[model samples]
Target: MINLKISEPNPRESVREYAYRILSENILDLVLVPGAAISEKEISDVLSISRTPVREAFIRLSQEGLLEILPQRGTYVSKIDTEQIAEFKFLRITLEQAVMKLACSDFPQKLQEQLCNCLEKQSICVKKRNHEQFFIFDNMMHDIIFTGCEKSYIWKIIQEANLNYARARVLDLSSRQDEIEVLFAQHKEIVKAIITKDTSLGENIIVRHINKVISDVDDLQKQYPEFFK
Candidate 1:
């Protein structure tokens, strides 16, 4: 049996939107796991919604490269694409390195504090072995940096373009629990560099931080070959 925790639909959300949101969140969070079989009828039955809305949601996720609709074989969650992951990593490294430089020059003090708070939450999540919340706070910290540098739109672009990269990250965190502390330490150093206006340090940290996953891709593939394309 599929173990989906169905959320109540929001008052203003249409059935389709609600279905899409829940399904997408589950996919990104790896609850649906890459390459797992999924069907509109099954999801509709699970969510207690009409098949029409569920079908629509599946089509949308398919367009976003989150679902593979095989003609006769049936639909399944999309596997992680390492090529796309490497592409997005390059894009992120280039743009975020520049953002780090800008942040070092004049990041807002308010945002700086928020980054520290995010780090503290991440620390707690690490201690508790809460990979999900740790991932959330990790993204939140980076979002704060982009907001502080007045480049939030750029951050949004990265988020939208990096879904595959995001899944790869979640996979890494879920599989390699031991690395959480190392990631937390890197985030701390990133915040420190910004606070002290250390552009050189901040830029270097961003590169290393973003490239860590790519460095592990070979090992990750060998360990979970089916999860990757």
Candidate 2:
């Protein structure tokens, strides 16, 4: 048996939680690609941690719908289920639309400044073609808006779904440069709608933006068939 012990404790959690965070991020970012075989031994070697913590992490991700553990076989990243994606789309659109509406009515100036700052960073990343930076900024931008909504439970769900989607999107965006300009333009529109308190326009913009993701899923499946299979 692999010995899974930590000499010290993490400020936020036990060793198991730390392990879960690292492994979950890797899986969600496609660092561990879907359908790519993984073993507890490999995880132990790579993380320099024991199988217990790794197993704990795997269980957490499996609960989050990002990994699968076979009874007798090795663990694997979960396949991209189109039906689940569709459900995600429906829930995200409806909830985010409502959230945007709330933000239009209640967002403070400080929040607007933060969002604009995130947008500026996005523009800089685009000009430099720094995808890693752009990806982080992309997340920050939505996060700011989601925070402005002030719906903690809904935000939690959206955050989870976004994490799952990010792995696939990072791959898709790496090849789809044309999408960059279009996405930025929509971001501007969303910001403008929020600033002007145009709830309808903001909601419409988000709906369209999410639709593009739905459109791109087919391409993602084609490019990374094994991941999706």
Q: Which candidate is the best by lDDT?
A: 1
Model 1: worst 10 consecutive residues (lDDT sum): 1-10
* Model 1 Cα lDDT, one tens digit per residue, 123-196: 99999999999999998998999999889999999999988888888889889968798789899999999999
lDDT for 195 (candidate 1): 96
How close to the true structure is residue 168 of candidate 1, measured as C-alpha lDDT? 85
> CA lDDT of each candidate?
0.92, 0.77
TM-score against truth, every candidate: 0.97, 0.88
Residues 1-229, model 2: lDDT tens digits: 3222323445877667877876776666566777766777877786677899988888888887888899898788887676677777888889878888887777878989998999999899889877767878877777788777767666666777765466667676677877777778888998999999998898899899877777798888887777774
Runs of candidate 1 exceeding 4 Å displacement: none
